[model samples]
Target: MSEQTTYEFHVAAQGDVLEQYITARGRNTFIMGPIGSGKTYGSAMRVFDQMCEQAPNSFGVRKSRFVAVRNTYPDLKGTTIKDWCDLYHNEDCQLGKFNQDFPPTHYLDFDLEDGTRVKAELVFLALDRPDAVRKLRGLQVTGFWLNEVKELSKAIVDMCDGRHGRYPSAAEGGPSWHGMIGDTNAPDDDHWYYELAEESHPEGWLFLRQPGGVIEVTVGKGEHAVTKWIANPNAENLANLPDGYYINQVQGKADDWIKINLANQYGTVATGQPIYKGQWNDVLHINNNKLLPIKSHGDLLIGFDFGRTPAAIIGHLTPLGKLRVLREYVSENMGVRSFMDFLVPELKREFPAYSKADMQAFCDPSGWGKSGNDENSPIEIINMEYGITAYATTSNKPENRWEAVRFFLTKKIDNQCAFEMSADCKTLRKGFNGGYQLRRIQVAGDARYTSVADKNKYSHPHDALQYLAQGAQGEVDYERTEQLRQTSEQTAAADSLTGY
Candidate 1:
């Protein structure tokens, strides 16, 4: 805001790539290009642009916050925002401010020799608290850029966007849009993004992929004019970082080494490795005609994974543990109102058939489900507000719940249960067959395990499974239910206290 800050990002063959991106960045609602195509660099520069505009806006100092989230902490650190800072502080950009307090949490906002102030600050966060996303609900954020979003659950994305906006101090907050960028290579055959790239209308989200990176561009205006670009930050903007850098970052990780680090595709090429030492034909249902019959009457536990991308599923269970996937619905790119238009009716139709006083749908009842990549909350807000009893499997510990899914599937594999693969449950099957990936394990005592998703990749189906499994046990502690109620009420009260 002090003076015009002149800068450009240098790329070898691309040649002054930042110049074009910096110019057209925010002017267009959304933009996408190949890897090394300058998407992140472009977006970061846009951060600078917003900061420039904010510095002079009389907010004391522009409290510009940039949110960069990934599936886990390491990915958030090693991949997404980490690389963005590299490009932003490159000698060419004339580094203003960086995360000076904690280098890992680099806050880059400094003035160049030209006296231009950098107002943008970053809030580096990871999806550690699945329920924490709702904290953003009813609030507004300046600029939110989700790096590798294919792996982010739809629920959280919506939470961020739902609360997305720039609340410049002293400015009446209406609808402030942020520059949302998504970067990813590609997802598996069953992933949600594969579907998003092809959608058109109030019906779906759009994604475009060029050689190195795939950009997920979300478009709209005011409260929702946010587009995301999903692409590879390494091969694209960081291509000139010398080969050693990638080897160090992604070396041993198979998914990283290939899907992103080396090969650009987010899918797994048949390495011919048998993750499950059994044949798929063995699990084929003999009753696989039109309308897969629900093998009824044995403690029907339903798992409802709420998501938009690949599709959320309603899995019906038999005591044998063999699940009959009853229903599957994908959100495409539509928002909550649209998603619920399909989900509520589906639940109504599906619930009655499986309804027992004890019947329940297990879900990630943490955040508001609004994005294609979000995990669906178990209890629907509309239903709840209307006094509808939406049976949900909410939990204090989600990791335990997710672990249960793996445990149940392993049991199925051991022939300890009857969970068989249905045609409609392709995402689940893919996940069980290794669609999802587990990150490198740190020394046990030192660090915790980190799991990552590849878009609608493996998690969607597994999420469905988790939701179903939640219903298996009727272990509802009325106390816990009360706690959840109290928590929600308390959150609401807190929002009120802050005048949110």
Candidate 2:
């Protein structure tokens, strides 16, 4: 190429949201949207914009380095890098050759209209590779772009956070901007992204959500109601997609998939039949406002389901017999003792008004089983090691436990349902909505689910909830059934005695 050959790069943000995302200057910024909402494009351009914004050094050259990261190598290469190349590599200008080594790298050297040269290095890395974390620990980039941030963990993001702002030493006019930017399609409610965007809202962090490509509307009425997805009139990046992109994408997809991927909603894709299918109503059972423990309402009933994944549900049984589930605790691969350690402090912190005396704890009868490492069972440990006394429920029968929960779910006390859950119980809400489910048995003729609910992240918490329900007046259903049995035997004996 001749020295006289000059290049100019031009790109525009697709929509208002994308424009806002590109211009956001938060120390940590992220954008979430549907499939073709220009999230990746906007984030990619933001890096270049930041590089050019940096002040020129003694040689009239603006310099910066940015890393583009994805959770897997295939995604980093196939999607993330492909999108970057499609934008920057064209006929009129060439950014630079992207080296395809272990960790791909690209160097961009261009001259701006102000006569200042922009020299930026873009590195692409994947977290799945064994050496990736080690390599990330050593990077000294000005900023980072987390492509599909939901696929990565908070640990990786935290690590990336510490590695930035160390590049372009102060002596050479340090970087004008140093931080991180990311983009992703809608993630599930259980994802860390949801916690950060919907709950935490940490300082110096900005999260923007673009309009969905589609909107869900319920058709029909009452028992006949069905959900239908229609194209959203205000979807972003429509000019760059096919005529019926959003509508066509939902052709044979599940409602959950359409809601999450196209509608840009936070929800899980249901695989099996929901455990509480028709019985559980999210709109009716889940309170619009967060529920807090009522001082007058009987003692807080805390239920536990112990195992590798220990779970607990805290709620109250009102004098009116209304069951209000306030909070839930779900952990992965944690022991009972450790889980209690994490939980007790949280309970105290969140519910300072309620003391140990105001709380009643119950556990699954299976908690009587001893752990391999310890002589005491989970229930024994809770009662003996900890000052809190946790009693084992009368029966761990699935049918009895299920009936106990169902009793409240279907029961109505003074017009409103006896069961209600706090808005903060996201996991439990998802479970009732369909995360806790019965595995569908593959058969050609008709659809059929297993006799029992499938074990999953949701099931553990649901188990705890069932225990809570049973302990808090739900056991009356079991006792009622037992009384019916005794009545039946007495009637038979009386009939025989009268058969003279």
- Pairs in clash, predicted candidate 2: none
What is the lDDT of every predicted structure here? 0.48, 0.82
lDDT of 1 by residue, 1-500 (tens): 45555554343333234444444434122333433455555555555565555543433344566666666777766756657667666556645555534224445555534444545556666764569665455434566666656677667666665554555544633223355555554555445554344222122233434344322233553235353333345344554455444334443455323443333444544333212212121123212222343535553444544434434565555645555555556555654456656665665675655433334445555533444553433354433442233445656264556545534443543444444444444445445444544443546574343443334455565565665665554433334445556776788899999999
Candidate 1 residue spans exceeding 4 A from truth: 1-43, 53-63, 89-117, 134-139, 169-179, 200-206, 212-500
- For residue 440, give model 1's deviation from the true position in Å: 29
TM per prediction: 0.38, 0.60
RMSD of 1: 20.6
lDDT of 1 at 258: 42
